[model samples]
Target: MIFTTKWYETVEPAGCKQRQSIVKALGLALGLLFSGHALSQNLVTNPGFENGASGWNTSGTTSAQIIESSGRSGNRLTHWSADSSYTVSTYQTITGLTPGTYRLSAYTIGGNTDDATLFASNCGNQNSQTAIPAAAWGNWTQVVLDNIQVTGSSCTIGIYTQNSDWTSIDDVNFELQSPPPGSGNDTAVEILAGKGFNYARIRLLVTPPDSYALHQDLDYVIAMAKEAKANNMNILLDIFYSNWWADPGQNWAPAEWFNQDVNTLENTVYNYTRDVLNQMAAEGVLPNMVQIGNEVNPGMLWNLGNISDNGWGNFVRFTNSGYDAVKSVSNNIPVIIHYAGVGSSATSWYASYTNNGGKMDAIGLSFYEMWHGTINDATTTISSLHSYFNVPVYMVETAAYWTSSDAGSTTSYPQTKQGQYDYLFDLTNAVKNINGFAGLFYWGATWTQSNNWLNAPDWQDDDAATRSLFDSNAQVNPAASAIVDAGGLSIRGVDISEAHYIESNGVEYLDN
Candidate 1:
């Protein structure tokens, strides 16, 4: 995580020459470091405008000028015309560089008029820009334009503003970034593990039609399970038992099983579940917990097992078949019955299934704040479910946005990085407070717009982007720290039956 900035200028800018010399002397005397790198130098000249706007180009009706006592460092550059509206740009062009990816960053604040951007262009790719939203008018926010492919040996980096209010920029930086290690998948899992997540939850679809979008087939899931094992994490395998996305409303049977009668469909479910687990076990990646049918509040396998249409008897039969299959694979793997939300309806749904002789080792709930109730509601429901069923309860899926975009209903949180962090911190604490709450999982932690399988509307789509814990560049967001901190807290009612069994048997669990 070290950054090295290469300063191209040996001479200080005009007005602040003496001050710059003093600062440099102090830095050398104290053995100061830049971005944690002792030898790192800034590639942008007069990055802080301490040199009186030297080594910079300005265009438009009003020229950008250096302003005193208003910078993130010593001084800053500002584009403001109080008398009239104007468009301006303060840019610096760096040339004669090695051809590779580079990152440009700057600290900026104040833009209430029109939109503005911190941008990089002509670096051997399409122009890259990070917009400074109109609401970013007071607090200083770090804006970065990364992954700038410098193919032509040069790139233009700067801020372009079309505003009547005002804008301030400081500490501009342009640095060459080394290529990342892998496809970013392994790094993402590692990041989650480092942040205190002990289990990796993956959804598996049976006989998916498309290989990309609905790609979590048996082989794909086995590969993912191996990855999780390699990362020293337990796996929670959620079997959808359908050919495509399966949720409360759309739990259709797979195409192959669509026409089967109720009795045959039950056997098919058992066989499919057993075969999936067998494959994973053969690969040495058997899941620590197996979820039979995801978010099946309405029942799984469609009409054949639909509780309303076919009665609780058929639904219970289908569910028990899957549960029996899990036991057949290994009695050690706990079985979880997943439901979509919290409340009386969900409680009654589970009650009916269990009353009809359905079996499960745990209860899983998808608790999204917008769709489900508040944190208080979740805590109450989790406690009730655990008490009623005498089984462990897990918040198997939850998420909050780090950016204000169209993901779903509005949340009490501000939809910013800090807002997301606060929400998760509060939610985690609430879950921990409830006795017997198994654990919590942040759903889609590694999802991003670039995930081809997601079929994002466009590059600008926020459906997945807003809620993902990682940004488009694969960088971990601030909310990850919340998860790390949450892991440190103790849950009062965690079930350690499996752990106890492992210890009592003298099993040597080796870290992969």
Candidate 2:
């Protein structure tokens, strides 16, 4: 008998329950889609802040001022300008709500604030507050805070800031989530398995105090890998090799590796990589493949390891150190070098790396349709890379919007749900048509509305990947079905099912 035990992924709180509950609600809704009825009514009055903050209780030295027609949805929004360096907060009591699960959300933009939070708390008791840190500057962002448990008939929803300046909020929403019958049968990993996705790619940071706080630490990545193993999913461990998000723009060495010479830095990479693999192995969730670094187009480790600033020799040495560390753990585990860009750009980057003796089992590319040109351009680039490197090429990062009604996307594909479905559907075919093509992995899996929620402080990319498998409400979207429609493609000896259903403790069971 194939016992398919349901496994749940636990989300560690960085600040509030937004990360934990929103993701859980979406996964739960994935199985309840066909049966349950959601009785949703926007409980908060003047949710869009269009009524000039009327119905809200404002405190502190600051005021909740209303600005006409300057919101996320192009409607009237409330602006709180902190000209003075003082603390201020605003709230509204939402009454007549039944004791049940609820989600409170708002769109906010903050600048030069010590800290800003959007929360939903019990009227009498502030201890049960479900909140998230808000900081979305330069553009508007939709902040969806789900999985709020209301034990009473009334809850206080509001925004609070301390020594903050220039923050605006709009589209405040608080709604009850009514679950359909016979839910909880499938988890997020199972839903992905059903949709022909077997690989779980997790990103790891050496010391991510600046990003994810306690969220993306080593223990968290190990927990994630163990959960993926329980679901019989393939693991692709992506090492950032930095203290924060490791891209060409913001890749910095961890504090321990700071001021180290080139040789010392190389040794640090080697030791860190080996220790990570060893830690993962101890948890019984060793990765099948490991990524050396993330999107090292300009180079990694900033001045010391960056190829552009230092030279090709230093960059190659750093990469080879990581590669050797992976092999030291187990020769069977494959190493991948990832880069962002397509066509001649990709070719030129690979040439520099390989010419300097960079060794990688496979090549990964970030082929966002909007950023990397059209599908034709991707096809040409992939073909050229394979011909030159003679190695398997795959899309390590790719995504589109499910609906253009929110954030406007310009990939020649319509912003509608159908457009999202068709984008991945066609992109899958394009990859499969090429010789030596490996596979594709969506960039941000749980992304729904705004990509601004991804990182904070600097908050780089503000893409609302509405094309995600789930919508802003955490319910299954049409783009998810599109992935299922693509089914599975064979790469080398590994098929989608095999990838997801690898042997666990000397037993392999094909789920469904």
lDDT of each: 0.67, 0.63
Residue-level lDDT of model 1, residues 308-355, one tens digit each, is 797888878898999999999899999999999998877888898888
What tens-digit string does per-residue lDDT give for candidate 2 at 265-362?
99989998999899778767889988898998877877787776788888788899999999999999989899998889889999989988999999
> Clashing pairs in model 2?
36-180, 401-467, 402-466, 402-467, 404-415
Give the lowest summed-lDDT range of ten residues in model 2: 497-506
RMSD of each: 20.4, 17.7
TM-score, prediction 2 = 0.59
Against the correct fold, how does model 1 do in TM-score?
A: 0.59
- Relative to the true structure, candidate 1 has a C-alpha RMSD (angstroms) of 20.4
Where model 2 places Cα greater than 4 Å from the true spot, the runs are 1-186, 210-214, 405-408, 449-467, 491-512
